[model samples]
Target: MNRLNMGRACARAGLSLVAMASLSAWAQSGAERLALAAAAPRLSEVVVTAVRAPQPLTDVLADVTLIDRDQIAQSGAVTIADLLARQPGVELSRSGGPGTATSLFLRGAETRFTAVYIDGVRVDSQSTGGAPWEAIALGQVERIEIVRGPAAAVYGSDAVAGVVQIFTRQGDGPFTPYVGIGAGNRRTGKLEAGFSGKQGALDYSLGLQRDMSRGHDSHPGSNPDRDGYRQTAASGRIGLRLNEAHRVDLTGTYTDMDAQYDGFLPGLDDHGLNRLATLGASWTAQWSPAYSTRLSVSESQQRYEMVPTPPYLSRTRLRNYLLQNQWKEGAHTFTGTLERREDHLVNAPIDQGRHQDGLALGYGYVAGAHTVQLNLRHDRDSEFGGQTTGGVAYGFAFAPGWRATAAAGTAFRVPTLYQRFSEYGQPALLPEKGRNVEIGLHWGQAASRLGVTLYRNRVSNLINFGAPGACLSPFGCFENAGKARLQGLTFMAAHQVAGVNLSASLDLQQPKNLATGTLLARRAQRLLKLAADTRVAQWRLGAEWHLASHRWENAANTSRLGGYGLVNLYASTTVARQWDVLVRVDNVGDRSYQLAQGYPALPRSFFVGLRWTGR
Candidate 1:
């Protein structure tokens, strides 16, 4: 992370500004705009889960954000990270460019504590935890619903931070198909297509997309390597319904990704590869109008290769299998989940393993203007066997269109493979565990949404990636160094005026270790985001700005990464009834900022694409 590498990211930001003026096509008449403006308030009525389940955002008793299809099309984004990076209480980072393994943090929680799901199926790592954001391309998505803050109530372990659920389309129509191809700077190319159809009582859909970048110098490569990255992915699903009493869904996905890190600087020349496959099926049926049940089962396998491919070096393998059942009766809802997971690692002559079987149960009810939920989980871990964790939550309607909520939960994190059995490194550390308490408020009306939340987390057995050494110098090790507390506030507000929509969010966190009286390094105490989106006729425009507070890279008084702010712009317009165009400029300030104080930040760049909106 030197200035030269910083400049590479800056260059990319500067290139995006020039792309905005190029939007606004000659087509897209005035009539279409009038039709949408009249039907705008009914936009949410199109969602199935929201309608059939009918859990109001405030009823969940937690802080949540829903990005519907309209917003996705309006943002003109090409990847999932693009949408998340602009959100409140979340930040995403990579070594340099797209298709690289991404890290996401919620509030001040670590990456592994967040859980990701695709169509109700868990997509996170079986061992390390957390989803690989780069592996999820945008082409196949219908909409995304993100529940931020501790979520031990509905989901299982590693949900101490939050849950991000993605729902792919299952073909809303019959025989609908689309294909697209595009290219950008640094030899970036994209190919994507999907089709949906139905016959009688059954409906099905499939989609595929690939993105590749022969990236530029977002950093000064030690060996003048081109810093290349590529990803290929495809997903398919089938849905069947019988007489409105029974419903079934089956899904499958495959992804492969490769990136040449070439090390951000000298001696960091490591290449990484990740491949994953997932398959799952679910069934939901109604015994009557007042009582219903849902059941699902899934399996997934993922392999990680670092440095020199598989056989020649270090690698990690993860396998996960899960089952969940839920029953709804009157105002009462009960859910049960059972899962088995394994994480296997190989580092030369050293081997480490972790196996876990966990079950979680929850009950929720609505009384008067208040909603209450209770949760419990039973787990048997390889290192620590037979444990139960749970939480309680309450949401009360305070006033017209306003709700208040609070929750308290207990959670734990398993030890890393290297922490337990790295023969060439430290091997004595144990698991980390913690408790979280939070409170929030939510309010929404016709044209606006406002949400605010306050939370605190106390964690013990915090793992430390120990300092550089001779016997254990560059390779890194770990330990249960100390206990700490993280306290923060998250707030977001969005509103529409005239033809323009505006949104803003702020995340403030202070993490400290009581034992050492020191702030946790590389974790920012404050982050802020602001954006504006407006549409006129067929033309749409959006702009964003972000600022992050500085923090230490290490507590030993080594170095500090300075604070910086970055900006981005997006614009799009319809070309014809079937075609549309998009242009985006990211990191417009060309600021050389570090998300972790030293790791290289992404460079300034621009991307343009053509898409189709309807069949």
Candidate 2:
């Protein structure tokens, strides 16, 4: 089925659901809605990555989402991709079960367009031009910040779609320890242990975990052998305070995994070793009440090795240094930043390196019912002489609990080493460039929040395989495709009805190649997500649903992948003091589906776990 008809059908279905919910809400008395609102907890207020500094989410005139630690624990999701799939303006396509290659698309943008960061360090690989989404474990993350728009004016290149920043867990209050274990279908099991503490002027956090699963067959028809996956990960963070005006901090995360797959034939002999690690340090000084500066340095590495066949190895490393200063005067604030980054890659057959230096300036104003923000950045790359980008945003409050925002920005993504130097590569390929504009409306109170965003983005110089007559190189065939456009609508609402919590979102998007007028590959035109959770006495119960519209698997648009919906249920309770139990059932109906063609998704799985905490 084509997306146009599917999108309309999905739209009608979504409207029906909304009307039903509204009627149900109206059935309740006005006082009840007020009471429900008064009792519901407010969303997390503070965010750091949107502007590269600390600010309230409301103060930023951008489409954003913040997943806190408590939410992560309550969602009963095992991987970062699983959690991200539930967010608005986001979609995920995994090749197989856990510990497999997964790709994330934001607002109809390509996989490489969205930048990923561990803290403040950019972690996308220089070899593949994409982040290892499968390697990022959710157990070590304290929070995740998602900004769904162009941010290259504040960050460097590779922010065309948006940015995802992950913060590692840190210590709080007194010394505490935690341990957990789990067993589930497919012969899956897990072990986890961690400790965290805070002293007079110091804080620390450490964690270790391992997971193994004898997964279902990836190729159901031809391959009946069960694939397997194993992962061991560790993470730590430390902070030290020199005085009231100065502080220093260090953080590190590591993951090592082995995953089995079906190669040419169905055999257990095909496996790969993957490793990801990031380390960083930062020093912050408060020179005065209105002035402050920070200096940070970080390194990120990703390595993959395939065995039992023709051996293959590839590794990528990134090093970064940044210095920024912020000054505030009344309702006006200004910031200046300088950054340097180096990227190196080794793929056995080829080795490459590049460097980039960048500078950015930002200004913000907030007073009464108006807010304004502006940023400009210039970057000089070793290969691509220079590029400049800028952004401006304005927000206005017309009434209590209501606000409107408009923003426009430019962004770019540099070509990876494999795209430039390897066989079938094009060295003359230009970096992809894009411009985006969005307007959003937000309404919220303590009990409920509602948001809607409309956006349009245009991209040029897209890199792709060359046509029959477009190739000029003897060893490769690559060319710069003309142009593309992506337009979308995002709707989100959260409310606490009586004692139960309800949240829902819908995303409708159209991504087309300007030259051919064809939809982009692997991006659904419509998506819907709904979640409900509540606590009664010592028991917590939750349910989630995700629906996606039809999408094409290839640019030709002939190979269509049907839409699918999934339902999940979760329950947790405090069995004893400092001890808890969690149980979950995924794909409750065992509906057959596929996010990506030729890759089968898991079906009807069960998991149960126990956790203990001590102080």
Candidate 3:
């Protein structure tokens, strides 16, 4: 089937589902619909952390996208970043291979403005205030949910650009077990298996996975790096649908990984290692028809080791524990969450001193079509003081096929210990703050989905360069001396036809210095991204294109990187319900260009994978 016919078929099927849901909601009651999902053999409703609570995407007041496990399995990418790099408004930069330091940017904001989570746990490094995307492999993800635009109000800090959350495997069948082994180019090999079952009244799930890759060709660099990587991970879960009114679930995971890449620092052989562990639990109870309370708690430990200066092994550890609760009544939901993230790091530099942390409190609510969220935090360093951030969004369904949303928010970021205390890296700076507002509209949900949003963000207390030689180093002393402003538009459309999905997104941003009236350094003003996913009978194929505008690297505007385009292709097929094959090609034209100053991107390469899904 081609795209046109496939679209028609999907439209028919989707219309039926929508009608069924709307009619059911009107004929039955909210309680009945909730009960129906459990009795029905097919699951058509999936709630996500996109909203702090269980809400359907179509009913959400914000723009959200979901990439399920089936899609992840076909991408044939090795890392979580690899899979998400194809997202509409996202761009990524990595120091090396999987398990190294990496950054993810959304819209036109820097990595520090984006928040990433795994099962509701903040996984970013407190020492740097950025999640290292390269540290995560995409081997076992169940789903990835992405919400765009400023969301600090509901999610707390680092949400100026939006949020990305990944949900991993929970368990399988009442009692079952399975395993698989595979290999490919780069001397890569994978070993994985898991089993779970019910012991009378108790249920459990345990799984283990390991992967090693000799790696592929590295980017062209002065000091060539031989790409090689290894990852070992294990997770277990136990849950009891104890009774209809109460339930509890507990899950834990541990992962260790290592990788090598071009350090970009002269003559330095870059290498890094990461060890991570997490334990989380969720408990829920119903007190009445319109009242229910859910309690969730999680503890995570993350440590990173890098040989920026060989043999001088250093480590940064993040120990985070959080408790959150939610109470729901009718269309009103209130949430109170307290998160304590204790960060301890030893930079081990001549002028660098050890740094540590305190905690932050976050609270938010969703009542009817209005949402409000806030975060107040205090750090070990007081100059930054107690920082408060939040946002509010009001939305309404104006008519059939039409939804409008208006929102405003403010957010702040304290300078990372790396940016403030690192002897070799500190830029001499204070914290940063920004305020922004946006209005957006959405049209059509099934046959076609289209959205447009306009936003403006203004920043102050920016950490920037002072008079050239005044500072001890040439990098300049950091202070909140200047202001920065950013404005942008995001346009997205999705049309699924005849088993094919055509999705496109375009973003145009202008970031400038309010003081000097010049463009901000190295920020892309225009970015265009598009992707097409198709399934022809048993074979599925996908393609993506990225185009970026020129950008500058400094206030002087002496250095610049030319605009560029990138294209990729992927194809896969299912041999049976239990097995499948994948082939992916990236950088098809092998165009050489800098993704960032002094840093080049990967050249043309291919990846092949074999997968076995659920039994």
Off by over 4 Å in 1: 1-58, 76-78, 126-129, 264-270, 307-323, 342-354, 424-428, 467-476, 555-557, 596-599
Error of 1 at 445 (Å): 4.0
lDDT of 3: 0.63
The estimated TM-scores of all candidates read: 0.84, 0.93, 0.80
lDDT of 1 by residue, 462-556 (tens): 87666545225476556677787876766555567676767666666766775576676667666777778788777888887888877666665
lDDT of 2 by residue, 1-615 (tens): 345875675567556654534211101111122223333433225678878988755466667677888778876687899888788888988877877778899999987899899877778876667888888888878899888889999988899999999998889999999999999999989899999999999999999999999988876664667878999999999999999999999999999989877666555467878899999999999999999999999999999887877677889999999999999999998999999989998986679899989999999988877889999999999999799999998887777666778899999988988777766577888999999998877665665666667789999998776654434456546668768888887767666787888877877888888877889888998898887888988899988888998999888788999999999999999899999899999999998888778778888888999999995
Ranking by lDDT: 2, 1, 3
* lDDT pick, better of 2 and 3: 2
Best by lDDT: 2
- C-alpha displacement of 349 in model 1, angstroms? 4.2
Candidate 3 regions off by >4 Å?
1-47, 96-99, 176-191, 195-205, 216-221, 263-269, 311-314, 319-323, 349-385, 424-430, 464-478, 515-522, 553-556
Q: Which prediction has the highest TM-score against the true structure?
A: 2
lDDT of candidate 3 over 196-263, digit per residue (tens): 67765467877788888776435545466566788998877787777778878887777888776665
lDDT of each: 0.66, 0.82, 0.63
Cα RMSD of all models vs. native, in order, equals 8.0, 3.9, 8.0
Predictions ranked by TM-score, top down? 2, 1, 3
Better of 1 and 3 by lDDT: 1
Question: What lDDT score goes with residue 514 in model 2?
Answer: 84
